[model samples]
Target: MPASLGLLRALVLLLLLLAFLDPKWPREGRVVYLLDFSPSAREGVFALAERLPREGIFLAFAERVERLPAPTARRLDLGERTDIQRAFLEALKLSPDRVVLVSDGLFPPLAPPFPLDALYVPPKPHVALSLLPPPYPLYGETVGVGVVLEAPRPAEARLRVEGPGGVWTRTLRVEGRKVLPYAFPLEGEAEVWAVAEGPWGRSEARLRLAPADRARALVLGDPALARYLEAQGFQVEEGPFRLPLEADLVAVGLGVLDLPEGAPEALRAYLHRGGGLLFTATPRGLFFGGWDRVLPEDLPLKPLGREGAALVLVLDVSGSMEGEKLSLAVAAALELIGTATPEDRVGVVVFASGHRVLFPPRPMTLQAKKEAQSLLLSLRAGGGTVLGGALREAVDLLKGVPGGRKGILVLTDGQVADDREALLALAAGAGAEVSAIALGQDADAPLLEALARRGGGRFYRAATPKELPRLFLREGQEVFRGGALEGRFPVEKAPHPLTEPFAFPPLEVLLPARAEPWAEVLLRSGERALLALGERGEGRVAALATDLSRSWRDFAGAAPFLGGLARYLAGAGRALALYAYPEGEGVRVVVLGRLEAPRLLAGGKETPLLPAGPGRFEGVARGEGVLLDGKRRIPLSLPLPGEWTPRDGEATLRAMAEATGGRLLSPEEAGRGVRRPLPLRPYLLLAALLLFLLERFLEARVPRGTLREGAPG
Candidate 1:
């Protein structure tokens, strides 16, 4: 029985050997050519198809793939939907070893059913920046054609201008992920090219430029300001009486005289005809009333009364200020006070460790003026500087003063130790402009500048005590009064409803030159929607109080939404990261397409992975701990345990998802839809089969060898 079993096993082995040795002419390697025939797919597909090897499978799909030419292996009809998964699965049926997917790399939102090795041939003749007519006219004018060169690190790119004449070359410096703008004068139909040559590769673009008709502007101001305007080549009119209707620029310096009653009507008509008016006030308060009506707010242009000017001087003295520094500050203060009118009420506050009122609100009397001088003479710098306390006290003293125009001039050499925001809030609410003069090298210029901006004032950096007076006097002329608030949207907790009410008092924003205009209503619930408000108008801007997370909430915590409702709003062409997710246990992460980053961020930390590939990343997570990006304090929690809901306080979660045009799905859905683990079962089965063959061979050959050796002995 054992011999018979051995014979049967030998027969089975012989049969397997015969099967392996028999040559039935092995089939040639099959190539499956996937041709995408979407409506937009043009000659690129046909060009790629011609490039493929002659004897291979050709599959075309617009509505379906059919009618194969000779030497083509097979044909398939994938109805309507260009489902890659369905086509891949059908290719698997044909058992093709190689696949060449020739299509515009635009994939429909569908999870691949099976793994497919695809060589994608994307469509060429790519348009980088969409060429559209400039929103503002640029016809027949030497308007600057800014060519933005975007690259990874600082790189050198050649900028070429091809117009009516020919191509002109210029060099450009490109910072990492930045668009370095190079200006070119547009004559006629022109193509601007920015070509970068580096280790990575090359990129180029050709933009069309046309002529623009130059618009005329009439500038009106005092001789000093008119000179500045004339320097900019504006037709300036220095006015005695209001200029004639033809003047495009009207600059009036009402040096203490009431503007003629007809001035407002004429100014209104001038503005209606696209004319500009720049009015500067004089010592007398004549321009205060009528200008207030024409301007958006009255306090923005008011004069710095005696009290406000006096506070500016005292703020210059403190413990940190001693010797020549203190004297210089006093001299600057005296110079500022000398400009004030007797009717102007002045108050003085001295701050060091605490606050003291040197002179309470009083009419600019001879005695008070003498006292102010005496106070300056008697001032001594000894204690630690507490600017916040001094600012609070100064604001308190100026609140009761009866004057439409008011300002606070602050002088400090150091940053405030405490309650800086509180002091800023008080100064803003006091309805008085707060300007600052930084003395010496130790002054916190940035902090002082922020303080000045919050209080609707200007900031000045004075190198020495000698410079303080001049800086203060020059900036004191332009006082920005009234409260304004600024803050960024919460990005950590997003997608969840945000319905909390936040308030920001009205503010006057000095629009930067040629700023790309955009407004966003960012809700606390992590929802931000862009709004279109027409170019340049001034009025009171308010944000309504509503719960953004509520069902019916429209303008909840959204300033832009509220601003849009009234059409009385006063207010980035940059591609930013939108979403990211982890793929499998192999430490790989995937980011949504269209976002370019210098490095990938995960779990609050940045990873050094080049984002130049097709938005997919495969690398070790670097560290043992989880990575995080953006605000770290906001933890991602799964609310309603066992259910995949975002924990409260994740302000940016919703924004991150929405910004990338993605949905904040459940963890289960994300795991199933976005991430797929590598399959180990096939490799394991192959290993098992290999081991079984070895075991069977060893059993058959070992016994036979041993038996043959023993018999010979």
Candidate 2:
């Protein structure tokens, strides 16, 4: 009876201990934390992550979307852009039952593939500076500037402009997000600033202004093209591609490749010295193909043929190419033949299970053109595609052709049983290039590209039959002007400074489309953005949506716009030299020129700047600003905060929280309500002591001699 009582006491003690010490398994759902690693979102992300439970939480950097190591610091320095959508999609693949996201909500929100919780950091107050008109005004010209303020409530903003004359200040009332335009004559270099006092406190933005300079342009093409540059205040100099020492820009015309031996190297050196080059050539110009090494490494430009070529049109007439593909292919070939000059021989080869020479190599005489057109119209699609045989026939036809360059333009709608490597080797051996046109989305793109690369020719793709003609025209004729763009698209006001005076007649873009993260959309067509501008390294790039061809119909009045864009891109070579950016709580100055020590002049006092890095200096400025680099004065400005369009992300955060079945709270509220790690050591120790006391008490009460201690038989 005594032993039974002891056992009951022990059982009660174990139950109490179990209740006090709660245990969890590793397999339990983890709270995966996906945080933006962008510059402005880093601090807030880390702060929120630190306050959350550590055991069940996992850390993933949203920039690259990978788990941070155990020794990851509380916060890290972030500079590059973040792809939030890609990061979220990756996080969902981990199949975490719960997720937490933190960001400043500056970037666009993409639909989540899966549900998750989000905590948004409040946006910091700031102002934006925008140049409104006269995007490329002459020196000492007056231009209109727009100032935008983003604040929580009504506020008074102080505006100032400091230039060759002196400092000018004005006061204006603003609420929420407001834009106030101001006109200022830019005399040499200038600086503009706006300071606003709002509910979130004081916010400021500074902008450096420099009127466009009259460029000294060197022209290598027909002097007629020089008229365009001359209209843009350029002192045109006619010469070969042998870049002159005084030339600020070089414009090479089509078929101009005879450089004075080391000229390309000299041009490379010139680019490093802040000189710019513009090549105007057909998409197949030799400049784009062989001279790419002279251009910037990150330049998103395609290669072109380096010399005039005797082009053989190799066409696929397989059964698969019957419908629209065959029709487009025939039309594209005719267009290419029309573009060939009398000096360039044009030939045609059609293939199905076998190859047939539709037209032998010959100059495009009037009679020859008619004959080619009639032959193309009569052709019909049938049988299987043997690409290798067609390529071999085309290469053989170009072997004896009298031309400095030789290549074949192959148009195919589908893959075929052919030895691709053998075809490439044959083309190479015959000293011929092979360009490929992949029609329709199902066309073998990688295969075509490989053929082009191996044969040392350009590759083109037609997403639909409608694009086949344009693609052919782009590649066949001298259309791609050495990556130069010319279009008359009417520009509605855009966010980028490059498109400040964006106003053009309604027109369509004809070039291939490209999208880079760093690029800013400057113009749009309905919902499709047409003109995109960006800066890479130290050079500026402008990508247009349409092909800028004489066939664009609306390009008659676009000369001014095209010239302005060219000058803008050329001047961008110097834009990076005098740039100022916001760093932490101050403005950092980056100059390309040589200087011993740099100091910032603000509000009549000098603030010494320490060397931040190579060719960079850092200092704080409250109002209008200027920089003295011992040799000369450089205007300075802080980056406008609205550059990313930061906003209060409460709505998005709430939506995400509800989607994932999680609660929404501010940082302060989260800190107060979030579960803290429970310490079980004390509770466990207390339970043990209580159990021991109970055991002693029970033993004493059991009467030592009266208790029977025999074992059960």
Candidate 3:
């Protein structure tokens, strides 16, 4: 008992002394700080590292992680590209309390749910020129050059493009930013360069062009369609669907055809490797076929006969829209006049403080067109934006027009001071679809959107006066062409082989379009579907509302849109597309399409593929090869347009931060933490006092003999 009492006394004294001294200790766990060491991030990384917590912090560079001090003061040595998700996953494995990321905000799109601190480092003043070279250089075929510039906004830049044909240069007046597209006709195997000169400096890149291989396609229905493919330079093969041969694509027309044994397997293999298939069949033949499981039903058909249309153009001449806004409005009016067929009827209404009928509704005869053009040119801008008044006038004019199809096109800055609900009711009562355009940033976007919603028509936005005419032209074309009476399917978002490149916000089309149970919506404008895809037997099929020619012009000749559509039609089958590049000691194979099966073919031998995420596979290759899945072999080819281009990715990073409830910080404000006070001292002092009292009480209760014996051995 005596010994136990003494030990307890000593422990109490020690606790008291330690509590008074109050020594500081490091926090519970270390913080991991990840740094991006890409070429653009080097200079800023050193400065960023100094801002991190001084103690219990580990440093990690791209692809490699190690303890601090060992990695200190080293050059920003890392890979050319950065994989943020991979690095983050590695950091998570370390089990740190928090992870800090220092980068220039150029990360690929990441899904939701993660905890991270993103410290943005503004890139040094520099311009980067990224080019999209054509996948194949076909002689006499024109290919587009896509250029993206990353530099300080509002700076002058000169783009000089040189190819085999000659040199082309243009001085571009860039807004905060711009995407410049150009076209060049291919001649032969040649070296091409796209050089950009700006305030930051000069940046140039070289690309080598080679001739394209002639792709083979089989047409199984209309002989005319086969002839059309031949005209487009495809090596055409025509026969029944049972033709025993290999081809890159297949097109079918309306008819009942017999399927051959193993043909379905062959087609399924083709679609899996990113081949395309198209069908132009009658509605009856499309639904009631042997392809029930794969083919889409309830497909919309074009109208049997063309119908005339009546269109009313409502223009806003408000005082706020004086200079360029008025000019663009007049130009749009003229374009609408140009689109009117001889049988179409047109009218015009102009409104500022009040609305006036510039031209009453009438058949678009040669004389009527001349008078409407004259009235539009004579108009001038003034007063407030009375949108309701103008819409009422247009509805009145269109009420009695003779046609099943009728529409009202309103072009304005969208600023208004009128009864909003009344205007919408007028549009709905007239039974004419009302489509609206917001001319500039200051326009009342919400009101215009609501107007179009109630009227059951499309809504469009023009960021600048220059874009106004195009929007008007598209609107005019729709009205003059009879308002999509031949219904088109608007795209709804779904995962498919065709939607890989569609990253923009969903766009909505006015007309209501739908898909069958087997079909999936791939693209949308807002809420409306724009494109849909499905399968037929082993082949893929697609439907589009927008005319291909008009879409090309509107999208600045986007080749991928057409190519992706074709690939969807071809259907994704069981195969892999491998492109090998020499890396360090071995070769790296990139899975081009969604790698359905993991296998490769080289010199007629098959090998299993080891997956490295983001469509990469590491392998040892004896020579060039192709990707394979069972009997299907997808040949190695040049990268697609979707692969060659790099996205800026600023929006993606912001979204990730927002989704995780984290804050974004700049370099000046990164890595600093406010320490909370530790209250261990008071708790320690109180515990020691209690233990001393307990020892004293126990010693007092012990007998004298028992104390002498003390914990008997």
Q: By lDDT, who's the top model here? A: 3
TM-score of each: 0.26, 0.32, 0.34
Off by over 4 Å in 2: 1-213, 222-225, 243-246, 254-256, 272-274, 282-299, 303-537, 541-560, 575-713
Q: In model 3, which regions exceed 4 Å deviation?
A: 2-36, 45-79, 83-102, 108-119, 134-141, 150-155, 173-191, 215-713
Task: Report the C-alpha lDDT of model 2 over 333-432, residue by residue, as the tens digit.
Answer: 7866765545567888999999999988897777898999999999999998788877877877877777676667888878757876776676567576
Candidate 3 C-alpha lDDT tens digits along 438-528: 8788888888888888888889988888776557655655564423323333334567644665643322222333455566766554444
Better of 1 and 3 by TM-score: 3
Q: In order, what is each prediction's RMSD in angstroms? A: 24.4, 22.8, 26.3
* 1-713: candidate 1 lDDT, tens digit per residue: 33444555565565555445542433445656566654324345554444455666666765555435632333343443344555556666776545444554443323333333333333322212112223222222223434344331245655554444445676655552232334443434666554544443455656555443322333223344444444333344555554455443344445212454355556555444334333433222212222432332211232222222223334645667888888877776665455454655666788878878878767656677788888877988877777777777777777677766677878888766767677667667857788777777888887788878888877888887767655644543343222211243322221211222344322111111110123223322222211111221221211111212221223233333221222121100111122222222223433322223434444567655455455333334432332232322111111011101111212222333344444343322321212223344454445545645655765676677564655534
Weakest 10 consecutive residues of candidate 1 by summed lDDT: 637-646
What's the lDDT for candidate 1?
0.45
Question: Where does candidate 1 stray beyond 4 Å?
Answer: 1-316, 479-713
